[model samples]
Target chain A: MLKYNFKYEWLLLIRNRWIQVLTILLFILFGFAAYNGTQKVKMRTSNLTSAINELQIKEREILSQLDSLEAGHELNISRWMMPTNPVVTGNLLPRVVNMPPKSTAFISTGQSDLFAHYVQPIVTGEDSTMNFKEMTSPTQLLFGSFDLTFVIVYLLPLLIIAFSFNILASERERGSLKLLASQPINIRVWVLQKLGLRFFWLVMVIIITLSLVFIIFDFDIKTNWMSFITLLSIIIAYTLFWFVLAFATNIWIRSSAKNAITLIGFWILFVLLSPTLINQISNTLYPIPSRTLMLNEMRSIKSEAIKKQDEILDNFLRNHPEYATNDSKQARGFYQKYMATQQLIQDELKPLLSEFESQINNQHKLVNASSWFSPALIVQNSLNQIAGTSTGDYQNFKRQSIIFSKEWRNFFKPMLFKGEKFKKSDYKNLPEFRYRYASVNTYSKTFWLIIISSLILFLVLTPNKHQIELIS
Target chain B: MILTNNLTKSYGGLTALDALNLEVKEGEIYCLLGANGAGKTTTINLLLGFLKPTSGRAFINKLDVVEHSKLTKQYLAYIPENLMLYPSLNAIENLDYFSGIANKSFNKKTLQSILTEAGLQESAFYKPVSKYSKGMRQKVGVAIALAKDAKVLLLDEPTSGLDPKASFEFGKLLQKLRQKGVATLMATHDLFRAKEVATTIGIMKDGQLKQQWHVDDISLSDLEKNYLETMSYNTIEL
Candidate 1:
């Protein structure tokens, strides 16, 4: 019976031109999404490269000035701004701490659109007060880019619903159901076979069209083949979830238009309403502190610390006598007082900043736990993780850059307090930033999706109370 | 063989089929004549096991229909008023599919042969059924019964909309099935077609069988007069 159903369904779909129309539609959707995603990645890479090259040029000029100063040559510069001064050299050049794009970065924009990929961290800047978010236009932020993730998470299920919604209802509407019921076969099994064949054909179309789009958009498939295969696995699983919903609606609903409306309602619930509702609940549960209030507190701490700079310096020298100069001149400069005041302000503001971090972390945990309620959220997070552009990735970048900023500041602290001269050898010892992407486990997500879809299919096929009600 | 004993069906206060009893043996066609709302369709639905009987039994080939609904369907074939086939499929494809569902597999040549034997032209066998007339579609329905080699055939108003030549051809096809010893029961409003094809005939009105007869014992004019008199409609000679 299944063999006959498969053969006839294939013939009908082909002869009716459904397959041809579906293939063309998929090609257009995938091609446009890939083009948008790849263009965004290209622009990010270009900006990061230019920042690094610009910093390298400045470093070379600083090195030449240091070489001239060491040869006892009188350079055309003021005494305070001399190359021999460690404070002057540290304030002159800063390192470009950056996070480069990952191999699968073109798969999704994710949080990449919200944050800057690189920052030039100077010795005197405060790590807690640094801005990592980009200055994007409000309109761009309101309506995000139409990338591949958006297409898969939002549009694919509507196509599946349109394809399989009328598999059984059309038979009854055409006056052939009585004839079909007279045969020695179960109606449920027949509907299953028909819908299963449609799902198989749709999967084939998706794989072929996605691969073609990647090739046309010049995606590096050879190097990112593992990510590509994982992507296809997630897509197949998500597709199965929607097909199972279609099967249930086809069995339970009695008319073609009613079946379509019911499936579309499911689509809206699972793909749109559930995720937004979960996010809203998570936020209400674990509220994040206001950035404006935190900034205001930080400003007050800095002004108070500046008024008491001398007393703060004296206390700092008493605690760390190693930074106290033994030279008889005991020459104190602006940096000597400024570094102490900055440290005092940072110490005062630590707990407020820690509370802010804790709240944001709690929000993330709440969102992750609640994401299980919606498959769209699960698949969206998986795609973002695969692309290495998730919110967690950006947070990790911010954390690492802050640690590197402190290290750069500490590297110059010893020379600034001890009042030592800057040397060419110290240039090579400056700190650099190296980003590490967080590891992801998408196989488990795909497995859970398949299991859920199978469970729904099983329940729909079984003869239960709901099945009886639907049939009657 | 097809048999029913005191079959009854009712909805609350209205009895659609009231204690109906009938039988069709091998090589016999029983024509059930009735008007609209006369329990003709209700009896057929009860026989098909599509509805539960209020009180009584129906059997096909000695198997109780309600107890072995799927099993009894193996020995019977049904054709509704307007038999529908897949519009996108040709006659041979539709035949192969319907036969395949009955656990019957046939080669293309064999399917074509069965269709031709059922009175469908060879040229129309490969054309899409969407372009076929009502008579051509009914011929395909007959071809399906032939392929299944059914022991019983149940039809509802199969000749209601056909022209004179098509109706005559359909009557001839029923005579051919009768020669094959297929017990057939058909519900219709045409007295002339029934008299020409049925071995025995019964007329029903208001959920009761008014009369029964062997086709040879009654003339066409007498059957028409009896039908009109039983229906309580005043008649005038032309």
Candidate 2:
């Protein structure tokens, strides 16, 4: 029966132009989305490459000057502007710290469009001053990029509803269902076979279109085959979830229009409403302090710290007597006092910073704990994880790069305070930035949840074998 | 091949079939005659296991219909008043699909032959049923019944919309199936056709069988008079 149903349904769908129309639609959607994603990736790569190349050009000139200085040549540059000085070198020769796109980054724009891919971390800049968000239009953020995840998580279910919503209802409406019920078979099995055939065809079309899109966009499938498979699994599982809903609605609802309305209602509830509600609740429950208020607090604290700079420096020298040399000139230098004052300011702002961190962490915890209410959020977040552009991914990058920035600053602090000359070999020991993705097994969770939900819906709608009546 | 044992069906104090005891054996055409709401269609639905009996049982091929609904359906073929099929499917394709649904696979040649035997014109064999007339669709339904080789056939107003000639032709098809040892229970208002085809006839009114007779004992006009008298008598009793 399944085989016959497959053969006939394929013929019917093709004759009805459903297959041709959906294939074209999916191809256009995937093609456009892949193009957009690759464009974003291209821009980031271009920015990083240009930054690195320009830095190389500057480095060559600086190295020539350093060689001249090492040969006992005197230059007219100012004290602070000279590259031979360790403070000058640390402040001027900052490396381009960047987060490169992952192998499957083209699958989803996710939070990538919202954040900057690269930052120049200088010794003088504070972690609080590291802005990771790029300057993007609010309208663009409101209407997010068209990506493969958007197509799968939002639009594919609608297509499934359009395809399968009328399967049973149309039979009953056309008066063929009575004839169908007379056959020596369970009605639910009949419905299951019909829906299964449609699912099979739609999955095939999606896989083909997505593969073509990937090939056209140069997705590097040979290197990221596992991620590609995961992407396909997520898509198939999500498609089944919608197909199961269509099956349930077909049996439970009596009218084709009603079935469409009910399935569409489910789609909107799960895809659009639930995530917004969750986000609203999370924000309301764990409210973070306003950035404006935080800025005011930082300003007042810095003002207070500047007034007490001399006091904090004296206290610091008294505690670390090793730095209190016989020549008080070195002890009373501007940076020595400034470095001590900066340390005091950072220490004083610790509680305020920790407050923000704890609150934001609580919000993320809320989103994670309640994401199961909507399968859309679950699949979207997982796809974002595959692309390495989720909010968590950017947060991890921001945290690591901040730590490296502090380390880079601290490495130059000792040289600056001692008024020591920066040598050519010292550049080799400067800290470099490396980004490590957050190790998360998010794929299996979404897959299992969606698969289990679909099976449960099937079992629930079909009931025991041969129980459905021929006529209502 | 068909039996109803004191079968009763009611919905919320309104009885649709009341303690109806009846039987139609091999090669017997039991035509049930009734006005509207006479439990004729109700009885057919009950025998098909479409509605569970309230107080008794319906059996097909000696198997309790409720207990072995799908198994009993293996030997049964049903055609409603409309004989609705997939409109997009041609007559031969419709026969093939329904027969396949019954787990009886036939080649295209055999299906076309069965369609031709059922009196459908060869020219219309491949035309979609959406373009078919009511009588033409009924012929395709008969083709499906023939293709399935069903032993029991249930028809509800099976010839209601046919012309006189088509109605006479359908009577002949029923006679042919009867000759093939198929048991038939047809519910209709066509007294003349009933007297022509039925071996035994029953008259029902207000969910109860009012009369039973062998058609050999009555004429066509006499049966119509008897049907009118029984319904009027039922109204008087009500």
Candidate 3:
């Protein structure tokens, strides 16, 4: 029975041009999304390359100046502007702390568009100065980029609803369902086989379309094979979720238009409404402290720290007397006082900073725990994680970048404190930054959840028990 | 092949079909005659197991329909007022699909022969059913029933909208099936065709079977007069 239904459904879909239309539509959607994703990634790469090239040019010129000055041949350079000073080198020639795109980064825009990929963290800059958020236009963020994640998590279910919403209702509407019911095959089983065949075909089309999109977008499929598989699995699962909803609506609702409207209502509820509602509830429950108020507190702390810089430096030296006693010169400079004051201010603002961090952490925890309520959130979060562009991924990057920034500062701190020179050899020992993504393997959970939801809906619409209601 | 013992169905206070006793044996065509709101369709629906009997039972081949809806359907075929076939599928495809669901798989040649036997045009065999006339679609339904080789047939107003020629052709098909000893129950409004084709006729009004007769015992005009009298008496009672 399943084989016959599959064969005829294939024939019908082909003859009616539904398959052709879907193929073309899917290709166009995937192609356009991939194009947008690759364009964004390309811009990021181009910008990083340009910045590195410009920095290298400056480095070469600075190295030549240091060499010439060391050889006693710097006639035109000013004394204070010299790179020979360790503080000068630390403040002026900051290395680029960058989070390069991961292998599957192009699969989803995720939080990529909202955050900067690279930052230049100089010794004078505070940890908070390494802002992760980019200077993108608010309008752009509001509308969002049309990437594959958006397509899979948001638009794909709508496409499935359009494909399968009226599967059984159309049969009944066309007056064939009664005829179908009279056959020896159970109607629900028949409907299941019908939808299952559609799910199979849709999965096939997706695998082909996504593979083509990956190839066209120049994604490294061989290296990111697991992520690719995970992506397809999530997509298939999410697609199954929508098809199950359509199945339920098809049997529970009597008319084709009514089935469509009901399925679409579910779509809006699951895909569109739930995410925003969850986020709103999370925010309302665990509110992020006001950034404006925090900024004002930061200004006041900085002001107070500057006024008490001498006293803070004295106290820092009193605590660590080695630097004071070991230096025979017994000298102090701008960095000595500034570093001490910076530490004091950071210590004062730690609680304020962690308040916001904790709230954000709580919000993330909320999203993670409640994402099961909506498959869209689950799939979207999974895709973002796969792409290595989720909010958590960026937060990890920022956290690591702050740690690296402190390490870089500490590398230069001793030289500055000892009032020593920065040699040409020191450039090789400068701290560098590397970004690592936090991987979460939630695909299995998401895939199984969607499949289970489909099965539950299937069992709920069992043939004999509810088919009478369907007829009525 | 079909039986109902005090079969009844109701929706709250409104009864769709009252207590009814009916039997249709092999080679017998039981034609149910009625007006718009009569229990003719209710009886067929009950026999098809599409609706449960409120207080009694329906059976096919001596198997209880409600308890064994799918099992009893093994030997049954049904055609509704509108013979709905998949519009996107051709006559042969629709026939093969419907018959295939009944566990009767047929190849192209066999399906085409069946459709042709049911009086579908050879030219229209491969055309989509959406383009076919109502009468042509009914032929495909008949072909499905033929392909299924069903022992009992249930039809609800199958001749309602068919033209005279199509109606005559449909009566001929029923006669052919009856000759093969297939039990048939059809709900219809066509008194003339019902008298001509059915082995026995039952007239229903307001969910009650008001009259029953063997077709040989009555003429077409007599059946019509009996139907009108039954309707007029219901109005008088009202």
Taking chain B only, the TM-score of every model is 0.98, 0.96, 0.96
Each candidate's fnat, in order? Answer: 0.69, 0.53, 0.85
How far in Å is the alpha carbon of B230 misplaced in model 2? 2.6
Candidate 2 backbone collisions, by pair:
none
Worst 10 residues of 1 chain B by lDDT: B43-52
Candidate 2 wrong stretches, greater than 4 Å: A317-329, A458-470, B233-238
Compared with the true structure, what per-residue lDDT tens digits does model 3 show for residues A1-472? 9878888888877888878888889999999998988888888888888878888888898888878877878558665567887767877777777888877877788888889988888777888756778788889888998998888887888889888988777877767788888887777777778888988888888999889989987887898788888888888888877788777777667788888889889988988999999999999999999999999999999998899878899888877665564666565877789988888888889999999889989999998888888888888888888888888888888888899889988888777776778888888898877777777697576767677776868576654465576665
lDDT of 3 by residue, B60-147 (tens): 9999998998899889999999988888888888888888778888888988888878888899998888999888988888898899
Lowest summed lDDT window (length 10), candidate 1 chain A? A463-472
Clashing pairs in 1: none
Instruction: For candidate 3, list the clashing residue pairs, or say none.
Output: none
DockQ (model 2, Cα): 0.61
TM-score of each: 0.95, 0.95, 0.95
TM-score of candidate 1's A chain against the true A chain: 0.95
lDDT of 2 by residue, A209-303 (tens): 99998988878789888888888887787887788888777777779999989998999899999999999999999999998998899999999
Interface RMSD for all numbered candidates: 2.0, 1.3, 1.0
List ranges where model 1 is wrong by over 4 Å.
Answer: A77-92, A328-331, A465-472
TM-score of chain A of each: 0.95, 0.95, 0.96
Residue A164 in candidate 2, Cα distance off native in Å: 1.4
Please give, for residues A203-314, the per-residue lDDT of candidate 1 as tens digits: 9999999999988887788988889999999999999999999999988888999999999899889988998898888789878889899999999999989998888888
